[model samples]
Target: MDYSYSEHKQCYVALDCIIFGFDRKDLKLLLIKRNFEPRKGDWSLMGGFLESDESLDEAASRILSSLTGLKDIYLEQLKGFGKVDRDPVARTISVAYYALINLNDHDKNLLPEFGAKWFPIDELPNLIFDHEEMVSLAKARLRHKASNQPVGFELLPDTFTLPELQQLYEAIYETSLDKRNFRRRILSMNVLEKTDKKQKKYSKKGAYLYKFDEDKYSEQKNKNGGTKMMFKPPKV
Candidate 1:
C-alpha cells in the first residue's frame, strides 16, 4: 500500500560539524561537550537543527559560527547518519560536514567557553554516539585530500618552512617522510613562494620559509587536476 505525502511522518535534520585543525606537528579535531540532556557532558561534534527556512549549508555555517566564531570555512558534506536510535532524545537524521580550520588563527577562547575543546586525532577519548566513526572517516578524507591538494597549508600560518610543511603531512600520515623527496615535490609545484625568513627555533640550519601562491596553486589545480605529494610510509 502506498502512503500519500500527507501520511508521511515529519522528521528533523541536524548538521554536525567535524572541524579539523593542523598546528605544525599534530592534527586536532574540535569537539563539544553536550550541555543539554540525553548525553550531557559527553564529547560530541558541534551540531544544530536545520532551520525551516535555511539550507543545510546555511545551518552548518550557523552552527559552526555559533560555536567557534569562525566564518567562510572550507566544508564538505559527509554521509547522513540516521539509525533511528542514533539520538535517544528524539529521531534525528544528522548530516555531517567536515571542515578545515587554521588553529593558529582561530580564537582559542571562543570554543572552550561553549563547552568545546580541540583534541588531537590520535589522542581522542571516547565520544558519544557514532562520533568516533565520523572522526575516522574524516581522517581518511584528510589523508586522501592532503596528497592531492595543498591541504596541509590550510592548518598552517600564511608563511612556513619546508620542514614545518613536512611535519604537517607526517602528522596526518602518522609516519615520518623522506625530507628530500617531500621538498622536491613541493618545490616542483611552483606554487610556493620561498621567503627570505628562516625558522631557526627547530633547527640550527635555520630552514627557509615559504608561502602558498594562491593564484598559481589554483591554476595548477585546474590545469593538472591537482599536485600530488606522495610519501610512502615506512614498512612495518
Candidate 2:
C-alpha cells in the first residue's frame, strides 16, 4: 500500500535557544547580532534551521553547542511557535529552548567567536520578529520554577556566599525579597554546606561561603516525596 501522490504541505523548522546567565548581580541573556539576510544587524536568540538528519533534541543541542562551544548545559524546551506569519520570510515553525549557565563557569573567549553578547534581561534591545514574546515566556517560566525548585542555582557559581545567592533570586524575580526570610528558607532546605572560606571582596568582615550539596538536596527531595520546596518571595 504505497501512495505516491505528492500533495502534502512542507515547511522549514528552526530551533531557537534562550541562554540565561547570572553575573552575581544581574540576570542576562546571551544573544547574537545577525549580520546576514532576513534581519541584518539585529539582536536575536541564537538559532539555526533544522537539518535533514537530526531529531529536534539533537538539533537543539547542536544549535546550543555551536554558540556556547560547550556541552551538557541546563537546557529545557520551552514551547513552539507556529503562528503562520511568525517568520516573514516563510511559513516556518520554531521550537524554543532555554538554557541556564553560571557565568563564572562559561568560557568568555568563545563569546566573540560566535558573535554572542550578554544583555541584561531588563535592558534588552528590540529582538527580531517574535523573539521578544519568546523571551517573555521564558522569564515567566524561570520565575515560576525558581520559586519551588533550586533550578535557579544553575545560574550561580559552584561556591558562593549567601548574599550572592540572594542577589541571584532578587534578579530573577525582579523584586526585593526579605533578607531574613530568604536566608532562613534556603538554609532550612539543608542543601547548602557552609565552607570556612569567606568572600571579602565586598565587605571588610567577609561573608561565609557555601556550596550546594547535590546529594543532600536529592535525598531531601526523595524524603519529602518530591514536594514543592518553596523558597517563597516577599509579597509585592
Residue 26 displacement (Å), model 2? 0.5
TM-score of 2: 0.95
Using Cα atoms with residue i matched to residue i, what is each candidate's TM-score against the true structure? 0.90, 0.95
For all candidates, the clash counts are: 0, 0
Cα deviation of 65, candidate 1, in Å: 1.2
Write one digit per residue (lDDT tens) for candidate 2, span 1-236. Answer: 89865797889999999999999999999999987878998998999999999998889999888777778988899999999999988999999999999887777888897788999989999999899999999999898888877888899888899999999999998888788988998998899999999999998999999998989988898999995565875443
* lDDT of each residue in 101-214, candidate 1, tens digit only: 888777777876888888888898788888888888888887887776766677889898888888888888888888898788778878899888898997798988899898
Which residue pairs overlap in candidate 1's backbone?
Answer: none
- Tell me how many residue pairs clash in candidate 1: 0
Candidate 2 Cα outliers beyond 4 Å, as residue runs = 3-5, 234-236
Error of 2 at 213 (Å): 1.1
